[model samples]
Target: EPEALDPRLRAPDLVDRELSVGLPDAATRRALLERLLADVPRAGDVDLGAVAARTPGFVVADLAAVRREAAVSAALRGAGSDPSEQVRQSDLLDAVGSVRPISLSGGGTLGSGGLTLDDVGDMTEVKAALTEAVLWPLRHPDSFARLGVDAPRGVLLYGPPGGGKTFLLRALAGSGDLNVFAVKGAELLDKYVGESERAVRELFRRAGEAAPALIFLDEVDALAPRRGGSTDAGVADRVVAALLTELDGATPLREVVVVGATNRPELIDPAMLRPGRLERLVFVPPPDAAARADILRAAGRDVPLADDVDLDALASELDGYSAADCAALLREAALTAMRESLDAGEVTAAHLATARRAVRASLDPAQVAELEAYARRRSDG
Candidate 1:
């Protein structure tokens, strides 16, 4: 935060120019690592490119520190005199883990896990829209350029609570091995003046350093609610302005994609939904019987089900269950089976029936209807 800086320094009339040095990109980081390792005794298996790709928020100095740490480890093991103790890929990776980059201190992580869109339960259209809006630009940049079109800047996912908006984002983060900066909107709120906007700026800065990144703002309504309607002394309004600035500001988003999820889309600032901002609004609806079955099967992949535990039949019985509710039902059923017998091997029909009585659907019918109405209004507009 620039809390310590004099406000006069920020005055355009007083300051003529300002220069900002950002964290190193993947290629620059690789080159820096190569230079640092040029004279060091290292194993042939050490791949700097892989290291560079994995270290998203690392700066040039961070790379140097990693090399220094690795060298220290190698020297402690008598690396200079013994070839067997030479710096290896593991040594550098271990060093990378030991050093924390300043850019990453703001909070974000490099994408990980093996989940893909296929793991999600039967949201074919949602998956397709996410693929086109988020993954295509990073995967097929040339195609976009050839067509003389810029990629989508962002996407908004809104639906009833527990309706799988966040689940879809998890699938997206794993789809392309891109960096992901995940943060809940409410986490950015600060009681101190200017702190919230600084946090917002810091988040985008970290995301930009990690290019081809996805900024997942879960519960984004808290961060960018309808402007001029807050009683918090204009803090929410300022946050909305900051978000608008970041969305279509002078500094282009480049390879970064912003995705926001909220249960209350109607509460979001209208300006945020404008073209070139979070323009692609995708409504995640409650799962139908087939989708509920898919969710049950996916959730119960590890849990053994008895011959009588028909997932399709159970799904049909669950009329208002959200994706999360379906998953919870299976979990509760497993717990019920465990309660019935400590040595129980499989969940039975009776266990599921008992579990259903406990884990009722959480979705509010009126809220769902209101969101559906909001979606219709956006679509018609």
Candidate 2:
């Protein structure tokens, strides 16, 4: 509806005056927040103006999400036991951390209708590694304290493209009731000077405020590419430096964990992979035959498959295929069947075979070898 209207329709004769809605300023956001929270019980420390200033471009829905998150936090903190208990300023700040800005990359907050480990196809080793690195520390803090060992600060998931690295991170995020700020690495890079570093700082500050938070950085290579001799005027280097400071600065990250995923881990700076930084490196390989079958079955859950279709056979045929590749195969097969006959009863093995022939696997042998070698080096370390 906001798209450009036809010239004839835009004329005063056909349409009335148009009013453009822009992002609310600080004062307007404060007014909106006050109105939205009128019925909600809030603590004396809760400042609507502060919340509004923090949320510059938030809309009505985002403000509503903040209120809902604050209420949830209050309930979790034993607010139900006391009828007079109110949502505190800290709860509102944490809620802001959970309610992502409208202009930010990625989607909704994790653990809010997010995918769990069960939703991901078989990746037993990968899942176990993630659990050990993230979930175990979060769920069993006392265990680490007893052993006098520091839990890993960050985890780096490196793998082939579409091999479910990001999916695994999402499952980890959903495993517990944690605040997750998901962002693409390249999205952090800003054209303006100092903006990227400031964004990084703000991101970590929010994560710290929302303790038990998970900052999932997808495509980390773009964010922390190997520094020195950079042509982009050191923007990437500055961003990486800022990220390093956030990860292992004088002020420690109490309960927050940074998870970074990338296909090219070698491109990431060495500083990021240090012991106190993104120390734990987990390799996510391409899906095996079993995982491929699982992916195919999951992808075809809604589609009507013919009895002649053998998922195991299709899986076996999809050698070197990633989970995404398997999904594409199923979609292509469905389309092939539809093209053959509009009234086709269901996707048959023949259709699948045609799709297999048409769509080749996307994995490059050289790249796979490189990833394997990288995994070996990490394992050795």
Candidate 3:
């Protein structure tokens, strides 16, 4: 962004001193909330400490906004006419949900979408592994300290596209009260020298400021490919070097975990996958019949299905359908029912049969085999 400013104003020597103000920690957040709510009429259920703990990335202004939003909600519910009506804890909680923190509104950050791992259909093993590697460290750090071992640094998730890799990230972020900063690997690249490296540093800096965070690097193969073979004026090589440096930087990632997702993990640099980096490599395999059934059920929870429409039978027939494909099938079926009869009350088996022809499977058999082979190689070695 400095590149966008005038040359004279953006000069490196123009500024005398730089001071960085980050989001408030838990104690500060509680104090700020208490001060803000001191004059407001609050119900006994209102707990500032609980609200402070939940607002991890919220700044001073965001906290103020939460108080304001809670008051507005109470007023809308006829608080002005009724003296007993006050801002309840539910109002504050809802206000927190409504207000988006400035720290998370940036391009580098992502919202958790309020989906937990339990919302995910199946992939029992994948969920269990991630729960232990990513969630466990943040939720139960004391266990690691008692065992005299450091928590895991990062995890690498790889599989065929549409196998719910990104979906898993959303679940992971929402599983706990942690911040999530996500960026596509290609988005980190810049033609200007040192800009990519600066982006990496800035990303990590933000993650550190919002401690107990997860930095998700999507499509990481593009960001950190094999070192020596690139025609792009050594920019890719420099980016890889920057990533490696940050992954094992001297400052250390205190409460931050980096999770990289790629469909082609074989293309990533070896150094990035070494110990203490993204060492926990987990393969998100394509959903089996049972998983597909679960996906269908999850996706069609709101869709009115006729008695004849059997998801289990449909999932069994859809052998190669990815998780996304199964969800899409239900969507198309609903549309088919709408088209066939405007007053149709529910999606029928015939509607699903018609929709199946339109929503073909996106999973590539060759890519799945290659990823499976890569997983085998990793396991063997």
* C-alpha TM-score for every candidate: 0.80, 0.70, 0.92
Tens digits of per-residue lDDT for model 3, 117-183? 7667887888888778877897788999999998988899999888888988988777557888999
Candidate 1 local lDDT, 1-381, one digit each (tens): 444679898788987577777668789889999898898888889999988877776888888889999888887888557756778888898887678676656555533355666667777778788889988987788999999998889999888888888877877665545768887888787658988887787778768866778899999999999988889899888988888899895577778899999998888998999999999999888888998999888778889999998899889989999999998998999999899889999999999999999999888899888988988998898
Whole-model alpha-carbon lDDT for candidate 3 = 0.88
| RMSD value for candidate 3 | 2.9
Candidate 2 has which clashing residue pairs, if any?
none
The order by descending TM-score is 3, 1, 2
Identify the runs in model 3 with alpha carbons over 4 angstroms from their true place.
1-20, 79-81, 112-118
Query: Candidate 2 lDDT, tens digit per residue, 196-307?
Result: 9978887876566455567888899999999995799999999989999999854677677889999999899998999989999988888889888888877687789999
Query: How many clashes in each candidate?
Result: 0, 0, 0
Better of 2 and 3 by lDDT: 3
Model 1 clash pairs are none
Any runs in candidate 1 off by more than 4 Å, and if so which? 1-21, 32-55, 58-102, 108-119, 174-176
Give the Å shift of residue 83 in candidate 2: 23
